[model samples]
Target: MALLSVHNLSQSFGGLQALTDFNMEIGGYDLVGLIGPNGAGKTTVFNLVSGFYTPTRGAIVFNGKPTRGMKPHEVTALGLARTFQNIRLWNDLSVLDNIRIAQYHRLGYGFLDAVLRTARYARAEKNVDRKCRDILDMMDLTEFVEELPKNLPYGLQRRVELARALSTKPRLLLLDEPAAGLNALDVDGLIHLIRWIYNEFKISIWMIEHQMKVVMTLCQRLMVMDFGKTIADGAPGEIQNNPDVIAAYLGDGAV
Candidate 1:
């Protein structure tokens, strides 16, 4: 089944057109790449899907539900989660705390229960901790659980972000520039990590990235955007050979 669909999606910022006639169909557990030049509106599309922006016009259906006007938290509750282009970790919090916070949406407790620390709330909190630890293990973050974000290396910090995102138990995960500051080896680690995420969790992934090495190798399908419009969409091999994508990159001097 199609986990997400976008048709004729268009957005504008006053006089600047950001996205136009964007259409895509993402199936279950698909590893899809959204890419293009620097100003290609890749992150904008992620925002639109995650409810950061209401489209000027279009339809976005996630898991057969309309996403129009829903808030970001609402999108997450509906089994959609995303990471930012910039790492937004709580620098002071331990890595375990980061993932534990993401699971709060699924916790079964009223405000009064939290305030009073009821027995039920205690049990719920314990379960959340166990689940968070399991997620940390999956991301290879167990060793750093007690450490704050500031103490971790850049590459490990990125994995912590993914671990936190996975704590949400999302069916579809949107990753924006997950490999942003990594060196070659770190990027390769992310490629394997992402593939493992898809295979083990059965989660569909859609990502926006400028790193061709990771995007081209990791994603099964690729979508090219230029000037906020999708210019080409196909498999990795086809996209690498496509003249339009090549020209779009070179024309924008991104090559």
Candidate 2:
């Protein structure tokens, strides 16, 4: 079965339609890219899928369960996790604390257990700490565990966000503009890191990225949108040559 399936999805704000009939099916270990011009509603699709915004029409089925009317945390609990276009790390918290907090939704301890400091709470907290440490180590972020997110370089902050998302143990990872502020070397490193994450975890990844080099290098398939509508979907090479996609990014004259 598909890991994620969206059918006839649409979203609107006031009089502006941000997305129209956006349909997608992501398989169990797929690495897909979504790309378009600035206002093409790429992030809008991610928002809808991640439950940040309720869709005006249609349905989303993730891991064989309907996600309609679910809150963002609810969707996250259903094995979906995402990073933002702009980094959303807790700047004031230590990197370890940030990663530790992402696992609270699954900590398996209730308020009473925590208030009384029960054995269950203790075990859960210990497990979370170990898992957070392991994740940071895996992401090459162990050395910065005690550092604040705001103190890290932009590229390392991006890694910390990625690590936090992975701490949720998501079946499908959504990365939004992960290479946004990176220099050329950092972008290259991001490509390798994303590839490594996909291979290591054997999970699906769906990314919305503006950088052509990042998408072309890391994505197995590419979906292009424009003016709240899908214009093209195909393999990376085909999308690179598609007249509709080329026209959307460049202009009709270029196509």
Candidate 3:
């Protein structure tokens, strides 16, 4: 079975339909890209899959279980994590704390344990701190670990968000527009970092990206959506040459 599967997924915000009969399957360790014009429901798909918003129709199955009404934290506990299109880091918090907070489910100690400062709580806290620090080191944000995210450079802020997502030790990662607001050099660095993450974690990555260069370089398979429907799904080379994709999203100039 695929690591993640969406069968006839649909979402509606009042009268406006944001997604319609969307279907996708992501296998273990797969890197899949979802791309389209603005308002094409790419983010909606991420939101639905990650349980930020329950679908209006159909079903999402992750690791052989249904995700019909699971909350965001519940989904995270099930080993799925995601970053946002907009940087969603806690601006006022230190970078280390931000990453540590994402590990709440892993701590496995209750408030009573925290109040008593039991050995389990102590051990869990130390383990979480060490893991967060290691993740910061990997992302090269160790120097800014004690600094607020708002004080960091844009690219580094992005890294913090990605690090926080990874702190959960997810089996599947959803990255929404990781290339947004990045310059040429930063984008190149992001591509390399994403590749490194894939190699290291061996987890499935489903990303929504507007930057064609990032998508073509990073994704093994590409799915194109427009007006709440999929226009194409194929290998990057095939997607780039697809007639429907050219007409709907990648213009003739893209070829």
Candidate 4:
């Protein structure tokens, strides 16, 4: 079964139609790329699916349920997670604390149970800590456990953001420009880490990116949009040869 589906999604900001009839289907374990010129509504689509914004019109189905008016955390509870193009982190918190927060719900006990530290509460806390540390290690951030978010370098900061997102235990991950502002080496590391996560967790990924090299390497299928509409969709190789894609990039005078 598909993990996520969006049909006839349309949204507008008064005079600006941000997305128009956007449609997609993502099956479990599929890694798809969403690439297009600036203002292509790629991130807007992510926002709609992630519940950051309610669409002006259309329907979104996730895990076989309607998601037209769900909240962001509600979406996360339904097995969807995402990272923003612009980094969002608790700068005052340690890297570990930031990531550890995501697993709080999995700890199971209510506040009273936690304060009491009953057997169930203790066990749940222990399990959460173990899993959080394991995820940190997976992101190659084991040594930075005690370091504040601001203490980490830019590349590591991005890694921390990714780690925080993964802690949500999502079935479908929407990554918005994950490689943005990353150096060459950091870009390579992100590529490896993302693939490993997909392999280890069996989660599907949908990303909005402009980096063709990374997109082509990480995704099996690619979708391109322009002016809030679907312009092209195909395999990486096919997308490269697509006339619409070429025109969309060139026609917009982007390249």
For every model shown, what is its TM-score relative to the native structure? 0.96, 0.98, 0.97, 0.95
Question: Which candidate number has the best lDDT?
Answer: 2
- List RMSD in Å for every model shown: 1.8, 0.7, 1.7, 1.7
TM-score of model 3 vs. true structure: 0.97
- Tens-place lDDT per residue, model 4, 1-255, is 778989999999999999999999999889999999999899999999999999999999999889988888888888898988988888999888898887765667897887887998888878888888889988889999999989778888888888998998899999999999998888898898889988998999999988887899999999999999999998999999888899888874654
The ten-residue window of minimal lDDT in model 1 covers: 246-255
- C-alpha lDDT of residue 193 in model 2: 99
Name the runs in model 4 displaced over 4 angstroms.
252-255
Model 2 scores a C-alpha lDDT of 0.95
lDDT of 3 by residue, 1-255 (tens): 899999999999999999999999999989999999999999999999989898999999998889989998989999999999889999999999999999998899999999999999999999998998889888888899899999999999999999999999999999999999999999999999999999998999999999999999999999999999998999999998888888786455765
Q: Which tens-of-lDDT digit does each residue in 178-221 have in candidate 1? A: 99999999888899999899999998999988899888888899
TM-score of 2: 0.98
Candidate 1: TM-score? 0.96
**Better TM-score candidate (3, 4):** 3
- Cα lDDT of model 3 overall? 0.93
Each model's lDDT comes to 0.90, 0.95, 0.93, 0.90
Q: Is candidate 2 or candidate 4 better by lDDT?
A: 2
